[model samples]
Target: MWKYIKWGFRITVLIIVAAFLHYTLPQRDIVRITGTYNRLTEVGANSIFYASPDSGTTTNTVDRRDIRFIEAVYPDGGPMVYRNEDTGWIWPPYFKYDSSNLQAEATNAISPKDKPEWVAVTHYGWRLPIFSIYPNAVKIKAVAGPDVRLIPWVNIVVLVLLGLLVLMLWRMWAQFKERMIEPAMDDLNNTLDAVDARADAARDRARGFWGRLFGRK
Candidate 1:
């Protein structure tokens, strides 16, 4: 049924929006730094995410570039890898251009497995092994411990602003329909009624006009 299709579309849209926010919004992970290094990476032309192509760091090659990487491990001994790249002046608005500084901070935070020094890595992105994509780290700093609690203030504020923006747009659309669309529709109906009252020929002409205007059956 049309109703089922409409609901399915709505659910699909909601899921996409949720996934987008999850990937774009910054998240903090408490991990112990293990190593810092750079490797030559081949970038696909179809990549949805864009990096700054660091001025001096990246060399001219066909779909290939040098990428900085920071390796770390979680409290549970699980491995975590992050990519260091400039976001430039666009998209995500992190405006991060200090990959070197962050790398240095991460290097300072590195501690051995016996005396693990917990550091919170702030980043945004999904690590898809199939695509060889890693989360881009924006900030790195020492934390009290792996159990330290971190609040997502940025997400809360951003969500609130987005809700207000949607509400404002909905109100504007309602006003437009009430003030313009409804009045025009009423005039159309009145004209059609007048045509119907005049004669059969005129009624046929009006029906033809109506069908042409709205494609109504």
Candidate 2:
């Protein structure tokens, strides 16, 4: 039971870590830009996903703000819309203050439905339409075709660094146990043993004196 519980806890932790990385890391989507426009969208309960007030371009007073939208379609004819917004100096740390430039590039890359020009959009975050949350596009570049493969170097490098960090922390903990904790415990045990020996010796001498005085064993 204990073994199963331990395994379950470990699996849960691994799942949580994987989910966090998936949400935080940048992903590339090979898409064909159909249109680019701005809409005055209301920021409400789902404001956490949107850009903050300090993003420099958007106003913070009103609930409605002009949100730049990039309408696109996937290779398999799936519609995917992305919102181009400044990420500011917080959160995911994109520090992206070039939403206008990215929007212009995306607009230039737009092609007709018959002759679709594939573009790679680098972005982070999820697009949940139900919650009115769209992925903020950090950058967009025109690609050769829709079939162009993108290797996720960011994810690879990040995972490698994280693995190294975990290994380093484990090594540090092991060294602490071996060098500091174990030696201190050994000293404590030795001192306890010496005290026990002295106590036994004192008791033996007292018993001998009492036995000799009373003429007992």
| Index of the highest-TM-score prediction | 1
Question: lDDT per residue, candidate 1, 1-217, as tens digits?
Answer: 9999999999999999999999999999999999998888888853556474543347568677787899999999999999988887767789887988988888887789998899999999988877788999999978899999999999999999999998999999999999999999999999998887788888789999998989854
Q: Local error of candidate 1 at 216, Å? A: 41
* TM-score versus the correct structure, for each prediction: 0.84, 0.79
Which residue pairs collide, candidate 1?
none
lDDT of 2 by residue, 1-217 (tens): 9999999999999999988888779999999999999988899898888888778557745677889999999999999999999988988889999899998999899999888889999998898989988988998988899889899998899999999999999999999999999999999999999999999999999999998989963
Provide the lowest-lDDT 10-residue window in model 2.
53-62
Report the alpha-carbon TM-score of model 2 versus the true structure: 0.79
lDDT of each: 0.87, 0.90
Predicted structure 2: clash tally? 0
Off by over 4 Å in 1: 54-57, 199-217
